[model samples]
Target: MAKGYKQMLAEADALVVSVTAEEMAGKLEDDSIVLVDIRDPRELEREGMIPGARHAPRGMLEFWIDPESPYHKPWFAEDKIYVFYCASGWRSLLATRVAQEMGLDAQNLRGGFSGWKKDGHPTAVKEKRRT
Candidate 1:
C-alpha cells in the first residue's frame, strides 16, 4: 500500500506547531512573526488573503527557501517566525514541515485562511506586482 495524503498530513501535523486564527490575530502586529500565504495565485485572487501576509506560491516554496537556489527569497533568510497558511491548512501544514526541516522556525496557521475568515479576522486584497 502506498502512503497517502492523509498519512502525510498527519506526520507533518505532528511535527509542525499549529497556531489558531485567534492566536495569529494577536500576532498580526508582531514584527518577529512573518505570515506566509502558500496558496496559489488563482486562489488568492478569488479569495483575498490575511492582511500583511506575504504570498509565496506552494509550487516554488522549496526553491524560494533554499539559500543556494537562484529563486531564494531574501526574507526567508531573516530571523523571523514563519507562519504558513493555505485555503484550508492542508498545503500549509506540509509546507511548514518542509520549512522546519530546512531549519527555519516555521508554523502552520490552523484551518488556514478559511478559519481566519470564519473567526472574523481581517483580510486584504493582494495587489498585482508591476512588471
Candidate 2:
C-alpha cells in the first residue's frame, strides 16, 4: 500500500475486500453478488470465460454504471454487490476501484482469471483456435 493511500483506506471505512477464486466459486450460486469480467473482448475470445459472469468490458464500465445514462443496466445499482476479475489481478483491481468509486459494494479476485482456473472452477472455453 502507498503511504497516503493506506491511511485513506483506514480512515475512509474501506477494507481490503479481497477473495480468492475458490471462495468466489462457492459463492457463485448465490444471487447476492454479481461476477463481472473486465477483460477485453479479444481476451475472452482467446481464453474463454467464467460461466455466468457478465462481460462489461473494462473500457465502458463507467458508462454502464451511470444510472441515468442510456447504457445503464440494472447491474449498476449501488445496492448490488460485484466481484470483478480479469486475465490478471491488475485489471480487476482497476475495475474494483471504479466500482467502489461509484459507491457500489465490490471486491477483486486476488489472482483473477488465472487464479479462478487454478482453483478448479469450471471455465467456459470459446469454440475457437487461438492464434
Candidate 3:
C-alpha cells in the first residue's frame, strides 16, 4: 500500500530542517542563504512570495538542482543554504527531503508562505513569468 500524505510529510519533516517564519526572516539577512519559492505560477500570482525568493516551480525542482542536467540553474551550484517554501509547508517539506537526498543543503520554511504572512513578515509581489 502507498504511504499517505501525512506519513510522507512526517518522514520528510524528520529528515529536513523545518524553520519558523521568524527564523527564516533572520536567515534572509545572511548572504549565504537562498530562498526558493516552489509554488505554482498561479499561486504566486494570487498570493505573492517571500521577498527575493527564487521561483522554482515544483515540477522542475529535480532538474534544476542536478548539476549534470541541462536544466540546472547556476544558482544551485553556489554553496548556500537553500530555503524552500510553498503556499503551505507540505510541499516544502517533501522538496527539502528530496534536495537533501540529492546532496544539497536544504531546509523548508515551517508553515510556508502562509506562516510568513501570519507571522507578519513582509511579502513581495511576484513578477510575472515569461511564457
**What TM-score against the true fold does each predicted structure earn?**
0.96, 0.80, 0.95
Clashing pairs in 2: none
- lDDT at residue 38 of model 2 (Cα atoms): 90
- Best prediction by TM-score: 1
Rate residue 26 of model 1 by lDDT: 92
Candidate 1 — what's its lDDT? 0.95
**Candidate 3 lDDT tens digits, 8-125:** 9998988888889998888777889999999999999989988888999999999999999999999998999999999888998999999999988998999999999999999999
Across residues 17-130, which tens digit of lDDT does each residue of candidate 1 receive? Answer: 999999999999999999999998878887899999999999999999999999999999999999999989999999999999999999999999999999999999876555
**lDDT against the true structure, each candidate:** 0.95, 0.80, 0.92
Please give the ranking of all candidate structures by lDDT, highest first, separated by commas: 1, 3, 2
lDDT for 43 in candidate 2 is: 88
Evaluation by TM-score, superior candidate among 1 and 3: 1
Q: Backbone clashes per model, in order?
A: 0, 0, 0
User: Could you tell which candidate, 1 or 3, scores higher by lDDT?
Assistant: 1
Order of models, best TM-score first? 1, 3, 2
